[model samples]
Target: MLRFASLGSGSKGNATLIESGVNDKDTRILLDCGFSTKEVEGRLEKLGRTAESLTAIVITHEHSDHVSGAGRLSRKYNIPVWLTVGTSHACRDNDFYETHFINSHADFEIEALNLHPFPVPHDAREPCQFVFSDGASRLGVVTDLGYYTPHIISHLDKLDSLLLECNYDERMLLNGTYPHSLKKRVHGDKGHLDNKHASELLKKLDLNQLKNIVGMHVSEKNNTEEYASNALCEGLGCEQNAVSLASQAEGFSWREM
Candidate 1:
């Protein structure tokens, strides 16, 4: 069987571990490394894993919350890292670890997982999200995104599971306490996915094959699990509980199609 879990996910840090294997082969990959090396190890230990269990690390962007610990982890564990050329340039000057680059637009395979890194509109040197498959079920992870592009919707159609961002509630953000500048950044074209916009994006996707839908990257002050899940449920025509929220502490549990 193929399964995955998040070590943690949020504004502070983010990491996802995916496992696929049966019989003679097993592969464990970390999607991002936002935590410090020891912190990542602790998180992994919480999930019954360790640093040596990971086959490689893949980064989505250069944001500190996504790449902060990536460099250190790779160096400590001597693991290969995959990212985009632009992302490489952004990190290269920093003497982090042994790294490799991939075209964000290309599709590649690693063991039993088919990996696809698609570009997204986020304020970074080069940011992309991922789609992973074990030849049967597909898991699409889209977070830290600004707006929903048609390409994203089309690519995410019929996914078995999705980890989509629902960063903030528009109303809360508009009326909340953030500075005017930060607020504008969060609401801008490359800011983040607001709850309402996330809901609208869900409406455009084909959820026929969807079994688990995760609302990720929620803002602590501007959003709530209740609000995000309810909005996505409504948009996807699913029950409230049918939609899950990936918390800052524990992202979510492993789910099957």
Candidate 2:
């Protein structure tokens, strides 16, 4: 069996837990450690997990909200960390327990799980997302992309589940209090996805086998759970409750695949 959950998601912090296989093949991978090591441990406790159970921590980028506690978490737990060479360089000062430089275009294995890392156009150094498989199922996660590309679309196609960014509502973002430059960056090609475009991207994907669809990393200032979830629901041609929303605090519970 394969399943996943979120420790937290949004601007304040971000982390995801993916677990696959069973018994000796059980592989637990933490996708990002955006919060402090202490906070991550507490959150995992709520989900019935501990740092020692983790097989590895795979970093998406070096942004504070994506990588802030990765090193400390790895060091405390004696878990290996895998990240792109450029992202590792950006975090050179961090003292990790173990480090494995990865390539954006490569596929790798961590015990029972297979991970396909792909580059994304986020502003952070060597940002990327991942597609995970446990032989029988596939799960795609994309949170920090600036914009969607054909290459990205290809990776996300035909998945069993997806955790996608619904960072902002375009109008709300444009009208919010962020400065003009900051606003541009959030909506730019190297920033994040607004509800409208996120919905559009969902429509382009093949969702016949999709069991779960979550709109993650929503903006507290620029979006509402209703707006973000509704947009995703519309694209998927499902009711509002069919779409799950991940908030900065109290992220949704585990969903199995």
Candidate 3:
């Protein structure tokens, strides 16, 4: 079986755990480790797992909220970390862990799980999203991207599960308390995706095999669970309960594909 879980998802911090295989051969990977070592360990414990049990760590970018504790976790548990060359250079302080530079257009494998990383239009040095497969089921995770592109749509096609970013509601973001520059940054081409854009992207994807649509990286102040859920539901033409939101604290529990 192929399954995944998130430690948390937001500007505060982010981490996701993907697992595949059965019994003794099971392979577990931490997609991103943004929390402190103890915090990540505790979150993993909630899913009946531990950092020591992880097979590897794959970093999406050098943004603090996405890579804060990746180095510590990898060093503490002696787990290998995969990241792009630019991200590796951008994160000079996190040089303690054993690192493997990955190509954004290439595909790689870690035991039973196959990962394909693709570039995304984000402000970070070299941001990317991933798609994972255990030979049968595919899980696509696309967050922190500023906008959707045809390449992204092509890669996310036929996903069994998806964790897409729904960072904010347009009106709320423009009218919220954030400073002018911050607002522009969050709404710019290199900024995060708003609810409408996320919904539009979903409508463009092939959902024939999609079993779950998870809204992730939602803004705590600019977005609400209701709005994100409603937008996704409208785009998918599915019931509200069919969509799930990945929270800033509890995130959602594991779901199998």
The C-alpha lDDT values of all candidates are 0.85, 0.91, 0.91
- Per-residue lDDT tens digits of candidate 3, residues 1-257? 99899999999999998999877568998988889999998999998888888999999999988899988888889999999999988985566468888899999998999999999999989888999999999999987989999999999999999999999999999999999999999999999999999999989999998998799999999999999999899889899999999998988899999
What is candidate 3's TM-score against the reference? Answer: 0.98
**Residue 202, candidate 3: alpha-carbon lDDT:** 87
Residue 36, model 1, lDDT? 86
Task: Please write out the lDDT profile of model 1 over residues 1-257, one tens digit for every residue.
Answer: 66878888889888888778864357888998888888898888888788987888988988888888988788888888888978777763334556778788899987778898899998888899999988888889988888988998888999888888999999999899999998999999898999899999989988888877888888988888889988898889877878888787877766645
| Candidate 2 Cα deviation (angstroms), residue 85 | 0.7
Clashing pairs in 1: none
Model 2 misplaced regions, further than 4 Å: none
Q: Which candidate is the best by TM-score?
A: 3
Ranking of candidates on lDDT, top first = 3, 2, 1
What is the Cα-based lDDT of residue 168 in candidate 1?
Answer: 95
Clashes (candidate 3): 0
Q: Report the error of model 1 at residue 109, Å.
A: 1.5
* lDDT, residue 252, candidate 3: 81
Ranking by TM-score: 3, 2, 1
